[model samples]
Target chain A: MATAVNFKSEESQAELIQLVSFNLDREEYGVYVLKVREIIRMSNVTRVPNTPYYVEGVINLRGKVIPIISLRKKFSLSEKENDKQTRIIVMDVDGELMGFIVDSVSEVIRVSAGEIQPPPSVVNGGVDQEYLSGVINRADRLLVLLDLERVFSQSERESLINSSL
Target chain B: MAILCEDEELLEGFLAETSELLEKLDDDLVALEKAPEEIELLNGIFRSIHTVKGASSFLGFDLLVKITHKTEDVLNRLRKDELKVTPEIMDVVLEAVDHIKLLVNDIRNGEIVERELDEIINKLIPYISDAFRESAVLHMESAGTSEREKEVPASPVQTELETEAAAPAQERPRIEAAPAPSPQPPKPNSSKTVARGEELSDNTTVRIDVKRLDDLMNQVGEIVLERNRILQMNQDYLARENTANFGEEFSKLAKRIDFVTSELQMQVLKIRMIPVEKVFKKFPRIVRNLSRDLGKEVDLEINGEETELDRSVVDEIGDPLIHLIRNALDHGVEDPEERVAAGKPRTGKVVLSATHEGNNIIISIKDDGKGIDPEKLARKALDKGLVTEDQIAGMSGKEILDLIFLPGFSTKEKATDVSGRGVGMDVVKTNIRKLNGIIEIRSEVGKGSEFILKLPLTLAIIQSLLVDVENEVYSIPLAAVLETLKVDTSSFHVVGGQEVLKLRDSVLPLLRLQKLFGVQGSETSLNQSYVVIIGVAEKRMGLIVSRLLGQQEVAIKSLGKYLADAPGIAGSTILGDGRVALIVDPAGIIEMEESGVTGAWAA
Candidate 1:
């Protein structure tokens, strides 16, 4: 019988962290492994009323409504240039399965928990540190770990809810 | 090993469960207004609040957890008959639900928000006993009431005792029982005491984003265009082949391609089909607020909430429908005293219903109010110089009612915030025309008025009657084409220096596409000419074209920024041979024709 590898368990036991990594433009970013729900191919998303610019819109994921956010736009990147490899990463944040559009998802990396360091304050001239949970150096690549909850301000989040109402 | 990891997934399961519980809470609240005595309803609402409070506290959303905890206390009291479900109590609870919805929205937006729930919690405190308010730690510890509180006014204390009383009497052996002799008021309804009766069953439904469906539609359109191109090519090839085997193969290929393309189109169209419930849901709240504000007794009855419409149409229809409903209440429905004086019921009725008829959905807003007075409308039109005295004398009642749709025309003496600020029915007409829909109004003085709006089921794919003027092909939406006829050239005569067609005693203005599009005239006169009668905003006109082409389902592709504002053209579509065919905006053309503009020449 083929066994399903318990990566989360092994990582915790070995004091290693599993990161769900994806590519944005040319840079690599990783979120905690537990945040990710699954990876799905691009599907139809219905535009919702009164959403913010970065929110591409909401989609019906197997009968459950989930909003899709364009990470590129969220980070103030230029408008998307659609390519074959463009994908949406479905992640469960606070129980909501939100799909964030990205260039493509890379492999999950296992790094010792001790290897993760606090994010640099002035990486590339004052990067937005609110979104950065931590940073891990893996070989030649610097993986910027994201704290997804910090992406929105309190008032802005309230406005989003008001618009939905 | 896997069991430990699966604990992470438990949070997601809890979220799904909590959201479902919240939805039930909302539906039950709305239902409680109609059936307040259903104890099961109160218990169901209490359980949902309890579950949310439990999960929120566990998840460390302190503010949400706190508010839900307070709300649960109030609900517990209400369930035990300690507090009546008064209007004030309902308001506070609904406000709490609104706050919870806001919190959910915040979480959805990826914010760890600590909201100020003090105001809502304070409002709810009046419903709870003073003991529950004094000590937060005590409230958390004592989940059950003391046996001495049995005679207390139906408080959260009594509810806990009741639940304990249902359990084995030995379970409370340590409690003092001297207060059990206190007299209690008999409950009004025996059936309202049971807890499980009011819980509403979960009806799971999903909300979809419309953009995905639009993208799918665009892809299907391209496939249909490709299929048409291939079929056209096959036709040319098959015409030259005399062999039976070649003909059979070509036909088979064509059949398969046709089947696939049609199915693909239908599936894509299905995604755009959303029930009218989204639009209808807001109306109940609107009517409630409006009736309260106006101090009028009005009941809003909505039927056919399940009617499906294209998502695009549904979005656009909301504003217009709101305006129409407000108009019906303000102008059509008289005040209670006025209604009673007029021999009508003291409470006015506004019925908003939608029904699917053939390929169109007919939505009617009928109100039993003071119907529109055509005489007053005619007088206003004449006063505003919109119509001459002679025109009023010759006009019918329906024609006079339509005059209200004229820009800057309103019979109301003073402008109010709701309806009459002089931005009259013209906007409604313009918006309906933009959707390629029609609106008709019927009224009888002292009786009532009804506004009927007819809209196509889907705007993505439309069957268009293709016609040619000079050398260019233009598509007239089949919905607007009333009829086509072959008219003798002699039937046309110059009226006011413009050609007019006289058909059966009705003089309809004739618009030629060659002249409309700035295409040079051919200089050759044909005795027989094709005339397509098209309707725009309730007015019908004859469109004189050179030839009539067969109808086909054309996928509407928007003309990019440069040509979007061009008059007389709605959008462009791709033909079988990859040629772009401009679809005629009949309403725009009719407006241009009425405005006496011959053509729009590029600068």
Candidate 2:
């Protein structure tokens, strides 16, 4: 919803936007702050059989069952070990709550909507361009704004799983 | 229109009350068709229509008021015996009831598509049995009348209706309770047949939205889990050596909390239950219409209508029950002449009954008309290519009968709108399966046929036996678990290259859960293992597990939309230890077993 608002606001001026950025396999990916419900430490995840390989399984979120996915596995990046900084970012994707496992959490960053450019044709971080809403060029490092909706879409997961099979 | 627009609540209240009254009216109307001389039924029908008329008139729903007002006049004449009950008269009355239903529904959706009320009113006018010219004059005289005159005082039946209606609604337990002072002989259940005998009338019910109950159930589920966790913690605390004296007090408190929570959960589950009569009531009307249309003499006897089921199940079980009843009437029951020729009674019997079996509800639809022929069903399946010659040759009689549930396998040569297009049975099977229920067929070639459906009483919470495979736990609903036993590896023998366990008198197919779920880490205890035997319909399979976690009351939680269709996994639930365990879908695993997914064993 915040992304939709940002996109609409782009017509008049470059509105400032907030993103909850995190690290996945050394690549900085940011999701709109409004989409992020919370960040919590990694907990026990019960593996569910016969799901997509990237699905890390499910966790009990305050008596609710929430599916957790491995962003590294999802992006086809080299898997990394969970450390002190590992966190699960619970976000709202198309009205359903799903959690994504990331290497570490980063500080909230503000970037002008105009500063975020269209995803380049050849991205080097192994994240698909379609999943990237835009690339943000911060002074210290490159930040990729993620379109969590597209990344976690039903058809996208189904097609990916089917192709892998 | 202006009044309804100004007070939508009044219109809504009218719609709700009228719809319920209309449903009861359907059943009463059908029963009246069978016993046309029941005065109490006539009076009750008249009062219900009069109530609808009163409410609609108050709401200024002019069209509804006009139609129901006319219906009331016709019913009043019937009540007074001024008009006789005949098929043509019943048809017109039922048709008017149907139009009232449409108008109520249209009002509900905020659009009225101008039905021809004049035609039905004119049709009902002839049944008034009074001089039409005189009645017209009376109607004109009553025009612009006060509310009291329009509502209750005008009709002669009103005075008697008021006295009876004011005699406490609590005297009625069953909506279609046998008429008071019934002229028929006493039924076996004397309590039910004895009408209006109770003095206590304090039980008043409030109408609640189902969603509110669902939310409350979820909250109670959370409370149950929290209580379980606290109890587990207290046990851990008591197990330690260094414990304060308060620990005993704490443990007692936890125990009390546990008992209270369990009671609370049970009560909430009870609140979610609705008597199966909500669905059963509609069937009499359906069977009546179908039998009349087919010109067959069939009697629908409903038993165990008071069986209570979780509301969700009751809501879904209606359609399948309807279809099965239709199937019984349309195909199972023979024509009156055919039955007479076959040396059977002219009035074929179709029994729709429900009964509680342990923790499950078993609803059976049985017909005494004509039983399904296994060979005939097999021939139909073969013709449809639903099964091959080899398949049919290998199947038993029950399996052959089961072929009717296969898609596109119908015995009827031509599709009839009344349940013979071959499309319904399979859908029925799917729907029952979705409710975690199993449907079975019991038939004799010449005697009769019965379709029995066994369903869990509640979907939200169930008693499940949790088992472990490679330290990963799974919960199998105890309703499906017939028994659990510790068996030696050597006792298992291979039959036709599939693992089979000889348990007592029967050979049970063995499915190793470790192999089916592909749980990582090899099994270290290879000698003795636990086998949880589960069955649906007539097929049973013994699931081999490493350790038994005993029985638990588990609240079923979905795997969410992302992993909703996990194969062999029914759902997920949180254990007392706060870890998630998958609930095994025994039916799905049974299907897999049929599909030849039995993993290879080294034994």
lDDT of 1 by residue, A116-156 (tens): 67778766522366787678887799888876755644554
lDDT of 1 by residue, B1-603 (tens): 011123333333334455556644665675575578999788778766766665555455555656676687788888878888876787789788778766654543335466666678778877887776655434434423441222223245535543443233222211221112222222222111111222221122233444555667776776777678666667767686545566676677778767767777776676667778667666765675577677787888899988988887886787788888988888888889999898888999999999898767888999998899988888888888988999798666777888887889877787777778767477888888888887888888888899999887888788899997776678888877879999899898987677788888567888877666655458349998899998766667898898998898888866432234456777766667555577788888777776666532211
Segments in model 2 whose C-alpha atoms lie over 4 Å from true places: A1-12, A157-165, B1-5, B110-243, B488-509, B523-525, B592-603
Categorize the docking of model 1: incorrect
- State model 1's lDDT: 0.69
Instruction: Report RMSD (Å) for each prediction in the order shown.
Output: 16.4, 8.0
* Candidate 1 off by > 4 Å: A1-165, B1-31, B38-77, B106-117, B129-244, B493-507, B594-603
Q: Rate the local accuracy (lDDT) of all candidates.
A: 0.69, 0.77
